[model samples]
Target: MIQRFIELGEGYGDIFEICELARTNADRLEQAFIMYANHNDKQVASLAISLKPVGDSKFMPIYLCREGIPYNAEKPSQRLAIFEEALAQLNVVPNRFEIKHSSIFSENNLYYQYLIGILRLNHYIPPMH
Candidate 1:
């Protein structure tokens, strides 16, 4: 089984795309996740949707809106609000995790690898076969 993160840019206009994907692929949708990380002293979030492999493709695509939305307690960002609304409409609750910033790694790919490890360790995703 192969699992990969398909980044759809930050939570700008791409957030709508994420919502659309979830709605369109409802059957394949496995779990929705909200990952919080500190980036440059700012609290940001990455919204992700894990999809089960389609048919026998063995490719599990994890759609993501990388760290962009400000995770403010006083007032949430529009992007975050939209994500919440979409999940509510679909009756899907996302699993949230607060993690260290991606900047801890020298490269972006390493950051993703770290995230994959964390998810696997927590049983959010299956381990390697």
Candidate 2:
């Protein structure tokens, strides 16, 4: 199986888009997760939803709002709240994890690859077949 992060222009109006994707594809929704990273000394987060492959396809699309929302557990950002509210409607709660900031990687693609590896290792996503 092949999994890829389909970036949705960070945390902006795209947050709504991500939520829409998950809601519209609720049946295919595999997982919802938040990754927190420290970028430029500020804690930020990326919200993503994993969708199952369609019709025996090998591609699993992970819709992501890469490192945009400010991370705050004590008082979650409104953006995060919006995402949670959307998921709540679908009875889905997001799993959270801390990750190396994208800035550490030379390219976004490399960072995504690293995240995919981590997901596989944690069993959040399937391993290579």
**Model 2 weakest lDDT span, ten residues long:** 4-13
The top-ranked prediction according to lDDT is: 2
Candidate 1 residue lDDT tens string, 1-129 = 678999998846799999999999888888899999988778999999999987788788889998878898689889998988998898999999898887788998998888889888888887777
Q: How many backbone overlaps does candidate 2 show? A: 0
lDDT of the candidates, in the order given: 0.88, 0.91
Clashes of 1: 0
Off by over 4 Å in 1: none
lDDT of 2 at 89: 98
Residue clash pairs of candidate 2 = none
